[model samples]
Target chain A: MTLDALIQRLRDFADARDWNPDHTPKNLVMALAGETGELTALFQWLTPDQSRQAMGDPHLRERVLDEIADVLLYLTRLADVLGVDLLAAANAKIDRNELRFPARQA
Target chain B: MTLDALIQRLRDFADARDWNPDHTPKNLVMALAGETGELTALFQWLTPDQSRQAMGDPHLRERVLDEIADVLLYLTRLADVLGVDLLAAANAKIDRNELRFPARQA
Candidate 1:
């Protein structure tokens, strides 16, 4: 499915549950943190190499995938609630990063 | 820009900086947490109503916009590095939610 489709599905899922009231930007951001925390916990103490390698382990990979999806979902919902366009915001930041971290001369 | 274009830009940014070594899943997750922390701090003490209102404040709105971008960029990066398809993962989760939180009859 496309990104927009997935976001709409999230909105629909929440609507189905009568969860829009609870999906305020505040609650969405908090839920985002909770999901991010879970994602972080999975990689907390692994050495850099182990962390990358974890993706190859079926069980670890599933959990990591789940947390990442959760974080993305909540973040997407927060942006939707705030009427902020995430791709545009991210693209703007990328442009800013270009200026902030200018390419070095070869 | 499309999501894939933005992701390619992120990859190029890291490549230019020789930052692939630093973009390990563990480090990316930690960085993701740091950004989410900042986002959470913005809403920490605000009441739900106040939290929603903060988005109406120009300064708060800009910061909120920036933090959400950072969260998305890092998440997109993490997913890319892990070879996990975010749209697919989120789609899978939505499907699970359908079963887990089945819609109630009115």
Candidate 2:
């Protein structure tokens, strides 16, 4: 599904609960931090190699993906509420990064 | 740009810097958490109304968007490095949420 479609669904889900009033940027960002914290916990103790292989097991993969799904959902919701065009902002940031971190010559 | 396109560009940017060894899931998730923390700080003290109006000021808007851009970039990188299809996972989660929170009859 497209980002727009997913955003619409998320909005609908919240609206059904009459949650627009509670989905303020402050609230959303706090919720987002909590989700990110949980996500970090999943990979926190793993060594680099174990981290790379951390998702090999179905159970761990599901847990990791679940957290990721939460992270992205809140992130996109925050962007929408802030009137930020996530794709455009990301593209612009990358454009700046390309200049900031130019390729080193071989 | 589509998420896939942005993801590829992110990968290219990291690869140019020979960042693969360092971009382990653990590192990426930690990085993501840092970005999310920065994003949270932007609105941490704002009240709900102030937070809603946070981006109205052009200067504040730019700073907020920059953090969000960073947050999304690290998040997508973590997903890519872990082989998670962000869109699919998000959609699946929404599907589950829909079941969990049905619309109330008015």
Native interface contacts retained, candidate 2: 0.82
Please write out the lDDT profile of model 1 over residues A1-106, one tens digit for every residue: 6678877888888887889889887898899999999999999889999998988899999999889889989998998888888899999998899889887645
What is the Å distance of residue B33 in model 2 from its true position?
Answer: 0.5
Predicted structure 1: lDDT: 0.89
Model 2, runs deviating above 4 Å = none
Compared with the true structure, model 2 gives a TM-score of: 0.97
The per-residue C-alpha lDDT of model 1 at residue A94 equals 88
True contacts kept of each: 0.74, 0.82
The alpha-carbon lDDT assigned to residue A104 of candidate 1 equals 62
Enumerate the chain B TM-scores of all models. 0.94, 0.96
Show how many residue pairs clash in every candidate, following the order shown. 0, 0
- Candidate 2 scores a chain A TM-score of 0.95
